[model samples]
Target: MDSKYCPDCGHPSSIKRIDRKYIIHEIEHVLHFERGILYTIRELILNPGENIRKYLSENRSRLVKPIIFIIVTSLIYTILTHLFHIEDGYVKYHEVNDGTVSTVSKIVKWIQEHYGYANIMMGIFIALWLQLFFRKFNYNFYEVLIMLCFVMGMGMLIFSVFVILQAIMHFNVMSFAGAFGIFYCVWAIGQFYFKSKVSSYIKGFFAYILGMVTFWIFPVIIGIVIDVVSK
Candidate 1:
């Protein structure tokens, strides 16, 4: 029996794991807001860079896993938008042919529907630009990707806040939400590298904006090429 458990953490082997107590405990923990999703959001909202740095260097257990955090947050935002019936520029792509949906339009629609998974894909794309701009810092590409998962996860929450406000106020505030979302992302990434110099922040802005532009523009270009080739 002892051999069936992990030597380090005493976790049971796959064959011995018939119980779902762990699953129930996790759900209870989240429902109670005890050092889980809510805690991660709070730390991220207040001091994302410092806290993420701490999570990377000091104690990983304090936060939800980066990828999981992003997925959960993205889902929350997705649900909020759906509940409010909100429309934003992020999903409004123009189709070239009338009565026909272009590949790019389909992609946009998919992204909107599955923002949780799509966020991870978008994070990977944005990480490339961050790697180029922040190469001097010596952080590897995957590290930037991890940082983005947390930062952009918070970005989703930030957008969710604006959505709630709009719903309550009965007015349009999505424009401000998008602008502030970008600003928060740039600031978080900048502060993550170093907060002393303005150069880090400036570079962060270019890194993020370029990454976003390249992500969207690349898809549009490919869709255009494919459309032309088919015609």
Candidate 2:
């Protein structure tokens, strides 16, 4: 304990203090996850920005890795949706199909059927848009990706809860999750990037809306390009 060297790294204690702390914290978090995954989920819900910043800048051992978290959440949501037969407005419209469903409804159904792919495609589009719009924040694509994974994973979890509730209560609140997703992203981005609450909310709102718009358009543009190329 009195030696001037880090016990873990064998470096000079003064210079390696931060590194030593990081290593200790990382080990503790790994042990914590072995105790329960709920601890990480609770921290993510209550203190997302701080936790995300920690994972991005410090040791990532404390939190579930972003990609794995996203995949797990997505799979849970997919299961809940199928199990509960929770049909969103779009899904309901798609089922009618008595020459009443619009082309958009069909497309929405297609997207829903391919939910995993759509989720990831939309996530990448949203992350790219965030990076472009918030370039001043100096977040690289990878960092933005981590942020999106957390936000989207949380959103999918919320949606899964809503789906379960709908199955039990026989009432539709599916759209509530989508609305919550928009607000959640806005609040999360604001908290993560901006110091001023008012400015952050303003920018975050615009960014979320524009991000969704871009996400929606990406598939349309790709489809058009494919059509043109094939023709």
lDDT of each: 0.81, 0.71
Runs in model 1 lying further than 4 Å from the true structure: 1-34, 89-91, 229-231
Tens digits of per-residue lDDT, candidate 1, 38-120, equal: 78888887888899899878998888888877888888888898899886733456656788878777667777788888778
**Which residue ranges in model 2 land beyond 4 Å of their true spot?**
1-36, 89-110, 224-231
Cα error, candidate 2, residue 211 (Å):
1.9
Please give, for residues 146-221, the per-residue lDDT of candidate 2 as tens digits.
8878777777787777788788888778768778767777777777776356776677677667766787766557
- Residue 174, candidate 2: Cα error in Å is 1.2
RMSD of each: 3.9, 9.6
